[model samples]
Target: MTFKNAFMITLTAGSILASHLTQAGSPVHITVKNLSDQEMYYQSTSAMTQAHASPTPELLIKGKGSDEFRVTNPALPDVTTASLRYTIGNKTCEFRTSYIRTIAPGGLFSGKLNTAPKWDKKAISSGNATCTVTVTSTNFSDHSWSVVFTMK
Candidate 1:
């Protein structure tokens, strides 16, 4: 084969392999929007235990504003559900949510969380709220997530 032809073939093969790896899956982006008149404090973290735990810092979003958290790994399983804990005013609530969008490989999904915390006068107030969400992607990787929001 001619040198030019051989080089072109090799390049094409390499491109195909690279595309498969990179296009295996798209990153996961979770968005939380504050619809109430009150401002909200929030944090997003991985519920699963990894070699290095994902850092989750507290954040605040003003009314009508939105914030996003992203997790990426094509090899990681698709997250079908997420746990959310939040406090509205003086009431604290914790609940598991299955409202995540179905994200296909090399595709993107955006899910909205607008559930207000329910009133419960039973459990003693610890001043802290927590929830455990379950996430399993296509690759069979399982991840637990905690996304907490509190009214400010």
Candidate 2:
């Protein structure tokens, strides 16, 4: 075969393999990076179709840093629902989303929290397998905030 024809054949095979990998429900590696200047604490809960995994114990992430987690739980193969709770300084915020029907194999999901004022609330979901939350202010009475990401 000509070099050009051989290259096209290889490209088509790679595309088919990628599509099969996604449909097969392979693992997804998710990284949570702390882009804020303050120390941050967080916990994650993820749920899938047949089974549910317990929420992870609270963990700490320093500023300008990142941590990685694998979403390979077979029970939560689809990971239809997930939540993230994080604490920065004396304030805490949460990001939750549901109906996340599909996360491609070898998928990457990233999230960041903007520095807070007093209280802030927001959530963002990207079509490119990413999510983000930003909090500006919160109620002084309870010192609590809820930030929910709406899936796109």
Candidate 3:
């Protein structure tokens, strides 16, 4: 092959690789911690509608323990929020938060929390709940990310 042809082929290959890298998104690692004395249930059904990325299965977080899951290839500019529900006795309390935006590919992009989670006054609930949400860039090369939610 001519030198010119070889150079053109190398340039084309490099361009394709770069294009793929640019389109690549980071997988988000999600963790939910139940800091209260009672078990908590994380429902993704409602949040899934607004979520750009979310865990596939619903989670049950034990009291004073945590559960973890992952979301693959979250798109950039992710505006995902979390909704947590807890049942103590006959009363069930639910808390929803504002969107936590993550624009960067990778490091801590944004962290948000509602220390005093709003409870539905109309619902007959009995409990005090707090929620925290954090989004961080874990790896840059592969664009790995982490999203942590803590409930107390």
Top lDDT model: 3
Clashing residue pairs in candidate 3, if any? 26-143, 107-137
**Candidate 2 lDDT over residue span 15-91, tens digit each:** 98776555422233334556567677764434341133223323777776665543233333233334565666555
Best by TM-score: 3
Order of all candidates by TM-score, from best down to worst? 3, 2, 1
Q: What clash count goes with each model?
A: 6, 6, 2
Instruction: Give each model a TM-score.
Output: 0.34, 0.38, 0.45
Each prediction's Cα lDDT score?
0.41, 0.44, 0.51
Q: lDDT at 60 for candidate 3?
A: 65
* lDDT of predicted model 3: 0.51
lDDT of 3 by residue, 64-146 (tens): 88776654433332333434555544445554433333333333444633122111111123555455566543454444556
Greater lDDT among 1 and 2 belongs to: 2
Q: Against the correct fold, how does model 1 do in TM-score?
A: 0.34
Which wins on TM-score, candidate 1 or candidate 2? 2
lDDT of 1 at 111: 50
